[model samples]
Target chain A: MAALGFAALFNVPARCLPIIFLFGAVGIFVKLLLLLFGINIVFACLAGAAAIGFLSIPAAHYKHAPPLIFYIPAVIPMVPGIMAYRMMLGLIKLTESTQTLNYNTVLFETVNNGLKVLFILISLSVGVIVPMLLMRKESIKHVRVPFSKK
Target chain B: MDQAIKSVRREEMKQLGKVLLKAGTMLMSAGANTGRIRNTINRIASAFDYSVELHISQRALSLTIMDEEESSFVSKLRRTPPHVINFTILSGISKMSWNIVQDNWSSEQILADLERLEKMPHYHRWMVLSLVGLAGAGFCALANGSPMDLLFTFLASFLGLFVRQEAVKANFNPYLAIYFAALTASLIAGGAVKLGLGHADSYAFVTSVLFLIPGVPLINSFSDIIDGNIQNGITRGVNALVISFSIALGIFTSTFIYQFQ
Candidate 1:
């Protein structure tokens, strides 16, 4: 999964293997840090996003390719796909209970999953967007080729 | 006078070569992993005084150059008249393509090699698409859904391939492409759920959308800002957000319509 994400991110016509591997290793470290600090998934995601953003600077400076390849894979583990599925299931079960099933437990589970997906999406977006906006003024200059003297 | 004319033409050719190189680099970089080529060409072009006509083809980078015409007849005889120099740069990025050590090659040689590589046949586009599909499938499976949900997810993934291919061909706004894709995927999922495919349909929908996430750009933008690349960071951030929002809007629209119905 990480490899696919890396390939998708790099999606360019050059050698980004080194960059991908380096970012992947750093991502594991960030996950470790999150575990050690006992941070919730939302905060952990934010921390991971920040770490990836910080680590990508050198690669961007040295390489003209965008730093996205490194950063995207680092956050793949926390994207809330499962939670989203659960939310859908919950909604369906809730609807079923109200119709003919009369199952309160299904209703409760559905609500819980729906709320979880919402919270996760909100937090993930906040974690990603806040740091990005805060550091907006720091992007590297694209390498401009010198124009020849006529 | 003849000797002077020859010297001027020689200088013009050198400048023309530089322009073609620069144009080629730009086109190649627009595709993928050719940053070094782009930089090298930019450097060489900066040293010349020529206009460049860059064409980005689906398979290769084509460039045409026109030298600035001399004002005086004497100067015209002494230098080459402004004219087009056409050349193509191949995109040499494939699983089979390996990078030679930069230390062993001069910058000019590297540029030449990249230009050569651009002409080599590689499966970069297909490889990227295949990987994306595989990952989307893997994510869907991991979500622990029923087989029906998995099939729906796979269909969504297949749809994504068409979206990406169209986006690349159109050079349309990546954000717009992402949003449309998201909406389409969500709609399909919602319909499936509504039709009694089980709650797994929604999971399939969300998991499939995962394949379209601009995860890399979001990360890259943040990294660029932290590293003091304010302009690059901001541009990338905006671009990434546009795509993300597009995906979100797609979901919102689909959900809204589904609910309304």
Candidate 2:
């Protein structure tokens, strides 16, 4: 299922297949590591980002478009797809419970799922952003123009 | 290289400055790394025969030209000073320099960087989101919610940005844009559920916001703040917040309207 999603993400024209496949595999592996470590979702996401970023070194060398595509798709497995869906369902179910449907069970489930989804999204964002921030820091000093014609 | 283009008015020059500013902002936001960014700025500076001095901070990259007399021309219609336009070639060379760096760096160094990145706090967040998203789907199925809802939500969220990208040129109405998109997505999910095509209500909520997730902007803003671009970072942070609210609004509005009817 994750592979299918990753495959679908590469719907762009003229992208390098080998790079796409490499990133795709790395993306899934990152997800698997997340599952294996039982770590916070955010860490898993960061792991995925790191993987994508490292893989992008080759793409960066090739002078193709920026590494976003390579990293973005590599991180697709980490997207909050199911959590978002569950939250929507939970909200809808909560609304439905107002009409004497005896939906206490549904309400409990909804709240639990919603909270989980929220945490997941927060974690995902943090995971992806933190490393990027660090990378930015490392790269900032190196951004100097060697010969300022001034 | 020989004929100097006539100088334009100060106002015209300012306009060109604005254009260049916008371009730089766009390029930075588009995720061009600092090296590429400096090279780009230098290239632009050299094009006008203006010597470029770049000041790099966490928040922004500031460029000052030593040659003030070289009239800047960012727009195509504007008339600019004729100078030795060697900067165009320089810009291309700067890009090539990145390739050179990538080639020179050992695979071991790249791997080390990746290892270092793995230890950062933020990476955990992405993993959590992915786990929850994938796990949520299975949980939804077990809970007896509509699977079709999950499918549509996934599909819609993935494609929503592309739709918005197309609509941006014709109509920049963000509210209308997202609203319509939400409705279209809901219709797909709702229809699938009604038809018994798949589980309808299972993972729709969590999935709906996939496209609307402000991961990039949030990170950029946070980085900006950490890098000392407080104003710009705060502005971006607020924008990300607003976008999050917008996604919530779109979902709330769509669901309310659908349920009410």
Candidate 3:
């Protein structure tokens, strides 16, 4: 959850910071609750992304900034570093002939890991964007957030 | 007076269209989501009392503005190259876009605004270096690191981020920057572990280097694809994948060479 500090690190205006924090926290909380139910990881991520997206819509309305300003940073903490690492490790094993692990086993694991990472990426994007799609087209009426250049 | 008025209006449209495109180009280059890019540009044009017909592709942006006579349209196109995040400039542009929506800034005023937005000082260099490096320690903690692991993570992250910034500023390929940064971080983490630094496994190394991952592109690519911008989405997705592959390659090289367990 500390990784969600990216909104601040990315220099998001302080007025909009607290709400982005809440949206990110809610997203993570939802994902954890789903996981405790033994929900599949991809679905959990999609749900998390959805919660982030849903919450950020109101935040965006309140902050008068782009929905993405809140949603993208809110979802950053869930990008799944372990799956990416595993995928890379599996590929490494498959490429080298000297590995103690069998080549077929390595290949299978590599493919599985790659697919999982791809699905997670897909889920995160689709999850957030679905909200935008379902909502009314964004108009200029709400673009009122003041930003500091500092 | 009517003749003079027509000529002046023509001049205003020409300048407004040019600067509006300029703002859109920079925003695209900075990697704002595709949807926001279109909305912001549209708002700028509407502010100037011109409607634009825009065509956005993977590498370039093109838009057309109708001539005052309605018989022809003037078009402008620009190629956009992705750059490092400068939230100050981005946030400044956002404010400018809002101001355009709220005020009837003259064409020259809009042009000046664009220039000032472009010139806003970037965030402090050392602050970025330290905080981003601190993000490395944050990753280690997320990985359940011991205190020793946190120290090593901080050192590796800060050092690697410096090199990565240098490579990017030198206009090295994005893949090369990711690979170099990941390799540096992993080597530092692995070396510290090898020296009996009290870390038990190589997972800390992976976590330390995870900051090199391209979170923005990955998410933006998906956003593009979902927006039905197939060409832009695929290009962004490929770019993100290549960068991730480079990062993985760097980590694999470290593991292979150092034989980190």
- Best by the lDDT measure: 3
Q: What CAPRI-style quality would you assign to candidate 3?
A: acceptable
Give the lDDT of residue A31 in candidate 1.
53
What TM-score would each prediction reach against the true structure? 0.53, 0.57, 0.88
TM-score of chain A of each: 0.68, 0.66, 0.84
All candidates in order of DockQ, best leading: 3, 1, 2
DockQ of each candidate, alpha-carbon based: 0.18, 0.13, 0.32
- Pairs clashing within candidate 3: none
Strongest candidate by DockQ = 3
Quantify how close model 2 is to the true structure by its C-alpha RMSD in Å.
11.6
lDDT of 3 at B249: 81
Q: Over the stretch B51-110, how does candidate 1's per-residue lDDT look in tens digits?
A: 444433223444444456632111111121111111112223221111322123233554
Best-performing candidate as measured by TM-score = 3
Runs in model 3 with CA error above 4 Å?
A1-5, A97-101, A138-150, B1-6, B67-69
Which DockQ-derived CAPRI band holds candidate 1?
incorrect
DockQ of 3: 0.32
Ranking by lDDT: 3, 1, 2
lDDT for A15 (candidate 3): 70
